[model samples]
Structure formats: structure tokens, C-alpha cells
Target chain A: MKKIVIITGVLTLTILVGYFFQHKNQRKLTLVEKSDFLQAFATEIGQLWRNADLEGDQLCKKALNVDDSYYQCHPDYFKCLIDKNLIDFRMKKKKVSLKISSSYKSIQRPTHIEYLFPLKVNGLYDLKLRLKDSCREVFLPQRYYPFLANQRDVTIEWDNFNKKVFVDRNLSRVWEVRQWATKVKNNIVLKKLKELPASDIAINLEIVEMQKYCSYQGKHILSAKVYDAMSLHPEDISSPEVKLFRAPYFPWSRKNTKTNIFKIQKKQDITLTEKQSENLCKRVYAKNCTSVPFQSYSSLSSTWMGARETLGGVMEYVTNTVHPKENIILSSKYYPWSSHVHRVGIRGYWDGEGRSMNNFDFGKYPIQVFPNSLDIGFRCMRFK
Target chain B: MIQVLLILFTFISCNQESWETSLQYDLSSINKVNFAKNYLNKGDLKNPPNTWLKLATFERVNKKKCLFYKTPYREKKGVLKIVESLAGKCSAFSKGRVYNDNFSAFRINYVSSTHAEKSNILEAIYSTGKEQLALDIPLINITSPKKYERYDNQLDFSLVPDVSFGEESNQLLLENGKVCHGVNSECQEVVGYKCDKCQNGVVEVVDYNCPQGGSKYCGPNKCGKKNQIACPRGYKILNTKLNSLCFEGSPAGFCEPGLRTYCNEKNILICL
Candidate 1:
């Protein structure tokens, strides 16, 4: 019995010792294998970067040397340049910057940076990003990187988080991306836009110089949103393309020349038979009116032909032709028609849709209609 | 003769009891061997002698509490018996002895502090590492002490996925690919892509396409073809080897200056 007990104890101790030794050795081997793989990985990539630049079979030779596996793994490295973004390419020395303002009285200063190529200017880039605020106030999209991307009209998004450093992720969902695609690269246009009041969002490209009121042809035309113009068409213009129009007048003859506004005859009110009001949903008319049919008064017209034309012809024509016994208002819409360097100029005609014909005389002013000019348009403003 | 036979039977029984106790528990980490003896005397833990091996498992009860146990050894059906609680104890390793049992395995059960009643049991029979074993212990059993469970746990460099080294390695290299911001050594042609009729001296640089109508344009090999250049987007040509005797008898289009189109190959040019 003693002999049997001693044998069992000896066997158990020997088995446990063998198991411990085996487990320790396995762990050591695994560590060694992992170390070898890591060292190889580092060495291969290091060698890949050593060759200044190689293409085709030459480049493949180096890649193959790194590891036939690496070349097999990434085939895109040696493909065509167009479809590929050339993410691993050289960059230019130039860079673009951005500036923005918020209605909350807080102004974000513009940031400047050096530029790189390929990514610097390709398709209109987007700086899609998100920033959390303690308060839940909704700020305008103007305060984001998308706006800056569109402002620069470049493929490079020089996006910075918390206003620190720029990072370019290939994010295209940002608002500025669409605008960047649509934007025309005009440094002068971008410069003029930055100088205007922050609320003026829409920028018009018809007018070359933006100020109080841009004069075209022999008449003066006020600034307006792109939608307000008669012949201004943003859809027709290709990306990175800007067309300039010049008026045929004085020093102001080419004021909005670079712009694409067209002249159209203003609409006059019809002496409607009450039947036309209740029966016809939309009246087809030959003339264009400043106000809609059911409105009590004609809305403000963005068309201006110098101070003389506004006080003399446009004001008088609206009073006599549409409303003759109401007050009038003129104001500019916020932002330019396009995202270019331009001013906001909209004129409002308030409650002036009735009779005041005999009070104001027309013989005291010189009147003229701009026919060949294609840079004139009008918008309506309402009265409280 | 009857008295001698009785003494031999008593000695044999005592030897069996001693062997069973030794196989059942090591009791090394447990300070009081007398306490283990008392537990055995109390019939809480028992061991039968002449067994090949007995499986012992450890269970950690709560953050500071754990238990070690001994069990009958069956190939896959060994049950553990609690030997001692390891909570509030030192981090000394517990070693198990393989008794006469042919198949024996170690298992660990840990009860988190947040969950006193629930305990997580992890078996070490088929697992290779402790991490895998911990994972096998279901998340439902790993009662997190605090309400917040942060995932800020960095990737374990040791257990990095094999796929990461293969696919992500190239991605990392590309992302970290440094640009030679110098001039002359770095020259990039503008508007050099897909210009069928090269305008403004912007020649229709061949974009690494197949010269043969049927063959597709493979990577970076645009050699010995008229107007053939490195694919615009695929590669940027830099540091030209203008006139070298390295390729004396090569075709006019083959290995020419600014046209050694070998895709992604590395070399220290010996401009002989």
C-alpha cells in the first residue's frame, strides 16, 4: 500500500511539471514569431519609401522586394492617375483661407494656409464637419467649413477642428461641397463678397463692381438676388466659368457689365372684371407685374435706374400704372445673388397700388427704357 | 496472525486517505494547512485515492474575493469543489496537480463586485490564452462595478488582427506618405489627364493605358509606346535619369529618360 501511494504521488508531480514547461515554451515561441513579423513589416515599408520615385515594372520590383504579399495586397498604388485621387502625390506651395461671422455677435476670423496640388484644386471639395455647442441655438450654415470650401472654390478642404490645425478628409456631404461644385473661381469676386455686410447671402455675378447701385446701359440698375433678374441664368454657366456683362452708359456704363442681367418690360395692373379673380387660378398676361394678383399692393421692385430714375420714372410709373395712393419702400436683400463678390440691392414699393395720378407730374423728369441691356432685374418687398 | 492482518488493513486505509488529500489540493497559497484539514474533516471537500489526476478550478468572487476548488477528473465532465476563496488575497499563482485521472482541465470563476450573487465561470480546457477565456465568459456575467463602461481600451498590440497588418498597412503607409515639398525633384503636370488632343502645350500624356486595343492598361508600365507617359493619377514622375548607358541597346521607347515606367519599384539609381 505504501509503495502504491508513493508511485501515484511521483507520477502526478512529473505530469504537472511537464505541462508547465510545455505551456511556457509555447508562449515564448508565439512571442518570437510575432516579433519577426513586426520587424519584417517595418523594414518593407521603410524600403518602399527609400526610392525617390519609380513607375511601372521598376516600381513593382521595389514593391515586390518589400514583400510579394504587399504588392499583391495594394494594386491601386500603381494604377492610373485620373480616377485615383493621387492621395499620395506632391503638393503645391499655395494655400487658401476662410472667414465667417455669426448673428450672435461672435465673429470667426479667417484662417490662411499653404496649399498642395491635386488635392489643392480638383473637384469642389467639402469640409463636412460637426461642432457641439453648450447652447442649442441654431446658427447659420455660414459659420461652418462648407461655406469656406465654397468660398475658396477649391477641392482642398482646409478644415480645422476647434480652429487648431487643418485636416482633409474626403468628406463630400458638407454644404460647401455643392456650392464648391457650382462656384466659379474668381479672386476678385471672393474679395468683394468678404467686404459686404454678413447677412447678404446671395451674390450676383452680372455686375462687375458692387456698391450702392450698379449702372448698366444708359440706365441705373440696383443690386438684387439672382432669382430677381430677368435674363440672369446660373444654370447655363459651367463650373469654374464666369461671364461678365457691361452696361452701355457713362463711367457706370460697364458697372454690372460682367453681370448677366437682361432688361424686360415691367408688368402693369389689369382692370380686372371681378369674374377674372374668382374664376381664373393663374392669369396669363402679356405684361409682368411687381405684385401677385391677390396682393393688396405692388411689392418693391429691385430695378433702379440711378437716383433720378427711382424718384422720377420707377416711382411715378408704379404709382400711376399700378397703385397711385400709397407709400413706397426700397431695401436690399441680405447677401448677393451668387457666392461671388457682389452687393445686395433690392427696392421695395409699399401700399402704393391705388390712385394718386394727378398729384405727381411726369413732365418734370427725363424717362428712358433700357432695351439692349441684359443686366437688370427686380424683386418684391412686403410692407408691415 | 489475525492481529497482523488487522494492522496491515489499517495501514493501507490510512495510506489511501493521505494520497487522496495530497492529490485533491496543493493548498500552497492558502496559509493555514490546518484550516484545509478542518474543512476536509468537516466533509466540505473530499478526495479519493488511486485517481490518475484531479481537476482543480479557481473562482474569483467579487473584485476582492475568489475561490479555488478540486474536482473529479473526467475527459470533459469534471466538476469543481471549492478549496478556498482568493479574494482580498495576494496574487500568488495556484498550481494544480494531475492525479491519476487521464483527462483533467482547469477552470476559473470570477464574481464581480457589482454582482455578489452572479459569478462568471471560465473554463481553460480548450482556450489558448487568458484573454480568450475572459471573452468566452459572457458579458452578462461580467457585472461592471460602475454604471459607466468606457471603451477607451486601446488596441492590444499583441493581438492585432492579421488582416490589419495586410490591408491597413498600405493604408497607413499611404496616409503617412511624405511629400517631397522641394522643387526640380518634384514636378507635377497640370491638366495632364484624359486630354485627347493636348491643348495649351499640355500634351496628351499617356495615362498608363494599353497600347494594344484589346489589352487593358495594367499598372505603371507605359514603356516603348508613342506619347506614352506615366499614368497621371497613378504616379507622379520625379528626378529624371536623362541619358544613361544602363540601357544601351533598349528600344527607343523602352527605358528612355522620364519614361522608365516601372510601377511602384524602389531603386538607388546608379547613373552610369
Candidate 2:
């Protein structure tokens, strides 16, 4: 009886132990299979964005549009997901539950829709807004005007420095016979013929007498001598030097014959002296016309109201003087032959082949100018 | 006599129990042994033995805990066993003979007590004593460009997924073919999917066929053809080399013949 009881107890204990291990192994295998299924599901979810035809659906289209605010909780969007078989949805009473089921045993895991469909709507909206902002045209004020029009217009009166009594009524049509006589080379014979009664001959001889002292053979006649001869003999009008101090003609110049000289001379021949420009500005515009300050000449538009030529205009005299004998002058425009002494009317103002506002040498060397220098002109500034 | 027989039978059954049940109640012991197995599998030791072994935990001696384990051998005497000390030396204990047919396939000299709790005993055992076996799949998390949030232009648009695992000792899986692991993983296969635009001409549509392409829907802008209009939104001029006028952000260009075209991330156009 004792042996049988011992055997029975031993057999039952062995069976129990064997069953426990078998059950444990089976549970472990099931856990491993469940883990593998979850892993596979996770991998599929990761690739679902690229694989699923979310673009084809109507609900997804509205949600993805950056302009539309439909991405935030649309019932149709969840319904679309259900229709596509991507997720399983349950609605009990007012509560909604979303689950993602795996292929193994239809085991489902509760899922957040946000993680599954992370639409980049906000990012797209931001990108669109930035792109629109980038395309906007920003207005920059016109910092520099290359060519500004003249502000005000005024008539200039001629300074008949050489006062002469002429028998010809047409002062406007009077040919500058004195300029021609000075160029004749043999003026000694013409001086002898001055006492004759012929009016043409007397006019020629008188003009010759005024210019003969002003001429120098192969030497530059300083503008001071011309000014001195005219200022000393203001009534002597036959001195051809009257053209040297004349106001320049602009396209907008008044066509009045009495105030302007409608002569057939080169446009460059029409110029004003430094002193003449200042005096004319004061007399004609009735304002203190000072030369643009040497320091502020380049940026004259900031303070002064006037148009300046950018490429080709007359050079103007400034008030700043480098030496007792030399004064500063500014040429706002570019001149191709700026270095030519005859054309510039001043020596050493420009030194290169072409002088532009950008490449112009400022105050490299001071310029020597008489009060009535003929090559440069000046504009009158009326203070605002 | 019957009571004596019952007590003796109980003692014998307990002593003859399997290793699985022996360590089942002691989870810490099971974890320690599993950690040692992982440490050995990670190539910390050279020529590690492959045979199964049984674990035996020793009481704390001299303020140090130790684990002793031995594999079955054909010889009865002089069976070698490994003693792993926790935070101390295991050389003080005298070697003893322990004969067990069922044993765990793991061996280690030392295992820190702190690391024992972190090891997944189930995963270690599931790998079934195989060398270089992948234990757990890494959990993926998308950290940037939060859902419904705009991407900053200042930061690069990174498509790389972040992967994380609980065990620090587990080796990271290599990405090849369909499965991508981390930032360094590359997808060699190109998807042939094309995206279409809506009738409004502004919004991009991912569908191949526009569902709203009826009279109400204006067709997509015709681009990449000679004398055609500029490319629509989300489509960039592909033949930029041939058409120098086509530049980034500039909506001018006609695609030249036999040149490739490309669409932005939205896949609004097909590159042909």
C-alpha cells in the first residue's frame, strides 16, 4: 500500500510539472508571434504614406489643401479611412474609438489618427506665405537721378561791355566782323584805312582797333586781359569779347531777340565768366547766386532744386579756391574731349581722355580762371 | 509511514525539477543569466561555448553576490563551471559538481547587479542560443515637422526616421532593401507614383486622375512642351540646362525635348 501511494504521487507530480513547462513554452511562442506581427504592422504603417492612394480620395484632397482648414477633425476623413480599409472605427454612443488590426488573429491596437496621417498642411501654408512674401516688389526711393530737369526759368540780359555806336540797325544780324579782322594776319594796312568815310570800312576798322590789342601770336590770350579791356571801356561795343561773357543758351532758353544773342556761333562759344555768372544770377533772378560749395557739388541735388545733366553739360565754377590764383570748378556731365584745353576753356580741370561723374578727378589740381572765363557756365540757384 | 513517504516524495520531486521552473520564481536570477548570455553573444569573450548550461545563484558572501553555472560533459569528474561575481571577485568559492541535462545556453564571468534588471530574459531565451540574432524591433518616432505644423525653411527637411530600443547592449539592425533603419539608411527603389493638381490650378493633388476634372474643374497647366505656359505649382523645370531661362522661383521656361522633369515633394507632376 505504501509503495503504490508513493508511485501515484510521483506520477502525478511528474505529469503536473510536464504540463506546466508545455504551457509556458506555448505562451512564450504566442508572445513571440504577437511581437512579430506587431513589428510587421509597424513596418507597414511606416511605408503606408508612400503606398496608400490617399491622394485619390476626395476627403484627403480637402484636408491636404493649405488654403483649406478642413484638416482639423473631419468625420468624412475618418469615414474615408474606414472605406479604404486602413483603420477600424467603432462609435458607441458619443464615444469614438479607432483601432488598427493586424493580420494575425485580427488582433487590433488602439491608434491615434494624428500619428497615422501627419499632414504637412501647416508647413505648406507657411511655405506658400513665404513664397508670396518673396515675390512682393519692395519699392526703393529714387536715391539718385542721373538727369534732373531745371527747376525755374529766367531771362538773361546782355552786358554790352564794348559800347560802340553802329550805323547798322540790326544789332542782332551784325556779323562779328571784328573777330574776322583779328584773324586777317595783316591788320596794319587795315589800321591805315580806318580814317576813310565808308561806313562799312569805319565799322571794320573800329572793330579791328578793339580786338588788335586783345590778340597774341601763337600765345593763349588770358581771359583777364579781355575782361580788363571790356570793363575799362564799357562803352566800346565793337570788342568781339562781348560773346565771351554771354549767358549760355539751353533748349529751354527764351527766344527773345533783345535779351539773347541769336548768333550763328558754336553753342560752346556761348558761355559765362565766373564773375558774370554770379552777377547775372543776382541781377536776373534777384537772389544771392553763390557757386555750389566745393564740398557739396557732387550731392548738389540734396539741397538745391535744379536739373543736372549726367552725361554732357557745361562745367560750372565753384566758390572754393585752392590757391589765390586757382579756383575749383565742377563738371557734372561726362565729356569725351574734356582734357582738350580749347574745349574745356580752363587748363588742368580734367586730365583723362573721358571725364565722367564717376571717374572725374576732384580737386586733383586747382584751375586758373579770370572773372570772365569763356569755357564754363553757371546755373542760378533760388533757395527753397 | 505514509506521511514519511509523502514528505520524501515531495522533497524528491522538488529536487528533480526542470531549470525553467527553478528560475521562474526568481525573476532577478533569470534576468542576470539572460544579461550574461547577451554579453557573451556581443563578442566580449573569444570562442564562447555553445552548449546549454544551468544557473545557480549563491548567497551574498563578503558583501558581494555571485552566480555559478556549469554545462553537462561526458566525464563525471572535473566538470568546469563559470562563476560570475556581482561587483566583486568570484574566485573565493570552491568548484563543485552539478549535473543537469537541461541548461540555458549562456556563459559570463561577471554581471553587474544594476544591469541584471534591465535585460529582457524572454527575448534572450527566444533567440534560442543563436549567434548574431536580432532580438527586438526598434520603435520609430517622427520628431520633426509635427503633425499639421509647417516646416521651417531655415531647417533642412529630413525624411530620416528615428529608431529606439530599450537595451543598450542590443546591436542595431542594418537597413537593406525594403526595411530602412535610421538616418543613414537609403531607399534605393524609386516610386513611380505621380501627383496631379486640382482644377483651381493652385492646390496640388496627389491623385493620378483628378476626380473633379469635369467642366467645373480646369485641367492642369500644360508644361514642359514647346511654346507652352510655365510649370504649375509643385512642378519644377527639369531641363534647366537646355532652358537657361528656367531658374528656381522663376516661373518662366519651356521644357526642351528629351530632357527630364521633376516634381517637388508633393509629387504634382511626373518626370518623363
Candidate 3:
């Protein structure tokens, strides 16, 4: 009975083991079958990728499919490529680059990078720019004349700029774009000063006199004197009749070249302080000294040979500089106002008078003159 | 102990007599299946004097046994069950091909015994019904033709090869019908005929196959790039220039201008 029991047990165990192993083998075979299917699919996908010539939609599809099939193995690489390619394709349109530079270092700082903008079919466009420069207010001592003459050039260039503009990180910068078309249409008048004739050497001088001054109807006044040439003596001259009779000239002493007539005119009296005198001259000649607009009498001499000819009119001279030709002078009635001026001899006649006179239609002022000027006595300050 | 042995001997003799009596009645029954059953274990019998008894039961059912009666006799039930089994065997055997090997020897033994018994029982039970005979019952035989002989007789074996499932179906039917019975008309004309085998009592019924035609299989032949691989009949292929100038009848049916191409089936530019 024990033998029977043992024999039965062994048979049962054998059957059970066979059953278990058979199922295990079956499972392994099933896995192998599935792997075969997957392997074939992978091969086909790889072949498609290899055969695909251009890297475009077809390639993208094939690649995506390949990666999808085997994402577990190469997720990062394919993901990055797909993302980068997508971005690249999205922005594949042509773009135009612009850089900007200034004509001079003093006019503008250097820009190191270029900017790009989308291109359009019609290239005609209005560009706007707002840039920062240490010398925003350019004292082109040269541009000053025509600037004062109220004249401007076409195609004024902004410097330190190319077709491109780069923002500086080191400085407190504020740059902007503006419509050059509209901005250029309007004139930019920086500052104004007197423009002296380039031919006659001008000397800013001071004069003092205590002679007997006379008046006409108390509304006009002048220094009473008459003199003969070849001698230099103030009181040796004869006295003119009307006592003052508007001094030497009436209304305006413009283009009055009487120095050859009277040697006693070597010295004249100045009537206003330097500050008051500059203001007076500015008021009188503000329009004539500008190149932009509202200009008055202009001398070709002021704009000759790229030289800066600055002129200051004062009733009193603060410095001991003398004038060579006080050929024309300006004096106002009932007021201590005098403007040392020159009258342009056009057709041999004084067309206008005072520092505000100009031969606008007559004289051709060279384009090279610079009309930069200072108070010569005031303090100069530089901004931070 | 002696008395006990005598009693045991007598008991054995009586049991043997009873077993013999049961076997004799089973062999003499009108149902052949009962006879088959009796014969299954008859190899143990010691007698050889049963020629007349065997002659009385030559694979037939007795007319007198045709009467309907219910009884709890094991042999009678066994005989009926065995008869149905035999009928199955007969059908299987009837369809056997000549060159086939391994003819299911075990099944043959089982079926032959059951079939003989079933025929006998059926004759005994339905002997009262009038006999019906088919006037033109078909008889057919098929053999392989010589290797050198052309197989042109096979309708589907053509140059282009009836590349269609339906056409193949029709050809198979024609070949089968010609081999087993015979066809009355051209296979193509009668190819669509399908007899309802599920409802019909006849074992073998007329069957033809459907024909092959239409774009269901062979699609439009002239497909070009960006064109529909298939189109409705009478319509031709059309190629469209995309980008600024759109092409008509692309797979998507319309094209648009852009850096994009191949809008897929919808025929629109795909934005990245």
C-alpha cells in the first residue's frame, strides 16, 4: 500500500511539473512572437527613415513614428530634435538687418550690435529711432552757422549707428524709434548767436567816454563831434550843429563807413553791460542769425571757409578789444541800446541795418561756416 | 468448505446461463445495432455453432420489430444511439479522397459498426413509409489529368489570374460541382446561385459562385503625386500646384498657398 501511494504521488508530480513547464515555455514563446513582430516593425520604420531624402514633413512623420515606436530608448534625443526643428521651421521667413553708426565720436557713442527686422515686398518705409548720446546737443561749431542761419541739410545722419542699433547694458539707456519722415519735416533749431562777416576782422572791445552828449527832441541822442583825418585827437575836431542831431547817423548806423571822413571816430562810446548787451543783440538779431527760419540780414563773410564767426552786441565792452571797422553801428533812440553792426554793400547801397541785417537773396554764404559763440564773460557749465 | 464450493459453483453456472440468455436475445433482435453490441464482446464465447443465427441477421431489421414500443431495455437505447453515430460515419467516409493517407482507422471501426446497426434500426422503424427514389441522382468521379495537358479547363487559372476572391469562389464551385456531380449551365451565368443549406433537407444542393468585377479590387490605375490613389468611375487624376495657386481635386480636394504642402487627405496646408 505504501508503494502504491508513493508511485501515485510520483506520477502526479511528474504530470504537474510537465504542465507547469509547458505553460512557461508557451508564455516564453508568445513573448518571442510579439518581440518578432515589434522587431520587424522597427526595421521597417528604420528603413523608411533611411530612405527618406529630405528632412521635411515626410521625414518628420517617419522620425516621429520611429521614435514613437521606440520612445523608451531614445526619448530625449528625438524630443529635442523635434522641438528645435519645429521652432526653426516656424520662423523661416527672410529678415533684413539694420545697423547704425554716427558720423563723429563726439556726436554719438559706438553701437556694437545690429538689429534685424522683417522684410517687406515694398522696401519703402519710415524708420523711427530714439538714441542716447553724451553729446545729444551737438555744438558742431560748424553746423552752428547754417543752424543759426536757419538752414539745414537733407539726409542728416545719426552717428554711432549702422543699419543696426544695439542697446547698451552699462549705461542708463533709453532708445526709441520715431518716424524720420515726420521728424525730418520739422526743423530742429538748437540755439542762436550772432554771425559776423568773415571778411572784416571783428574784435570785441570795451570803450569809455565822458564827453558832452547831446539829444534831438529828447527822443534821439548821439555824441557831438566833427573831425579831420591824418590826426588822432578827440577835442581837436569841430562841433557839429544840431548838438546831437542823432549822433553820427539817424535811426540805424548801418554800413556807415565814415572812419575815412573823420579820424576822431577812432574811439566810440559803449552804452550797455555785457549781459544786457547780449540780450539786446539777441532781441535785435535773433531772426537774422538763424539758418532754420526767421532769419534776417546775413553776411557771406560769416559763413566763409568753415570758420566760426561769433558776434556779440553790447552797449558796454567788458574786455579791452578794439574794432578795426566800426563802419556800421546801431543805436536806438531814447534808450542806451547800441549794436555794432555791418551793412552788406549790395549794389553799392545799405539795404538793411543793425546786427539783424542780411542779404538773403544777394549773398551766397559758403556751406562751411560755423557760427559758434559764447558770452566771453559768462560761466560755462557741463551737464552730468 | 466443500459445501461452500459446490454452492459457489452452482451460482457461477446459473449466472453464466443468464448472461448467455441475454446475449442470445440481443443477437436475435430486429435492430442490427443490438447485434453489433452483442458481437463487441462475443470473442469470449466458446461456441462456434451459430451460422444459422448469424444468417438470420445479415445487416437488416425485422419487419415485425417495427412496432413502436417503449421499454427500459439498455440494448434498445444503445442500438438507437449507435445508429445515429453510424450515419455520421457514412457521410464522412463517402467524401474520402483516394490519395489521402491515414484514413482514421479507429473512426472507421466505430462508424462501420454503428452505421450497420443504424441502417437496420431505420429500416425496422420506418418500414411502413412508402419508398421514394430520385430519378436523376448524380454520380461523379474525378482524377488528375496528365502533367503535359493544359490546365485551361480551370477557369481561374488564366494569364491575369482571376485576381478576385469572388471569382475564385465561383471557379471552386464549378470545379467541385463538375467533380462531384455535374453542372447544367455555364459557371458564370449560374455562379450567383446559393442554396440555403441550413433549411434544405437534401444533403447535397446546387451551389455556384459569385463573379468578379468592379473597382472593389482593382483601384483607378493612374494615380499621380498629390492625387487621389482612387477616384470615382469616369474621373481622372489631377495634380494641383499649391502655394498662391491652388490645385483642384487634390486628395483633400483643394489646395492653398503657403510654405506648407501635402495637406493630407483634407487637402489643406498643415501649419507647423
- Comparing only chain B with the true structure, the TM-scores of all models are 0.18, 0.25, 0.16
Native interface contacts kept by each candidate, as a fraction: 0.00, 0.00, 0.00
Q: In model 3 chain A, where is the ten-residue run with the lowest total lDDT?
A: A210-219
lDDT of each structure? Answer: 0.22, 0.25, 0.19
Residue range B32-137, candidate 1, lDDT tens digits: 1111232221321224422222222222222222233334433333333233334434221343222223223333332234341222222223232233322122
TM-score of 1: 0.16
Instruction: Score residue A352 of candidate 3 by CA lDDT.
Output: 23
lDDT digits (tens) for residues B1-51 of candidate 2: 457556655655444434333223222212112234544444222122433
RMSD of each: 29.2, 38.3, 48.9
Per-residue CA lDDT of model 2 for A17-61, tens digit only, reads 675554342232221123332233333332332223344455453
Candidate 1 docking DockQ: 0.01
Looking at model 1 chain B, which ten-residue stretch has the lowest summed lDDT? B167-176
- Full candidate order by lDDT, most accurate first: 2, 1, 3
Interface C-alpha root-mean-square deviation, candidates in order: 27.2, 32.5, 48.6
**What DockQ results do all the predictions give, each relative to the true complex?**
0.01, 0.01, 0.00
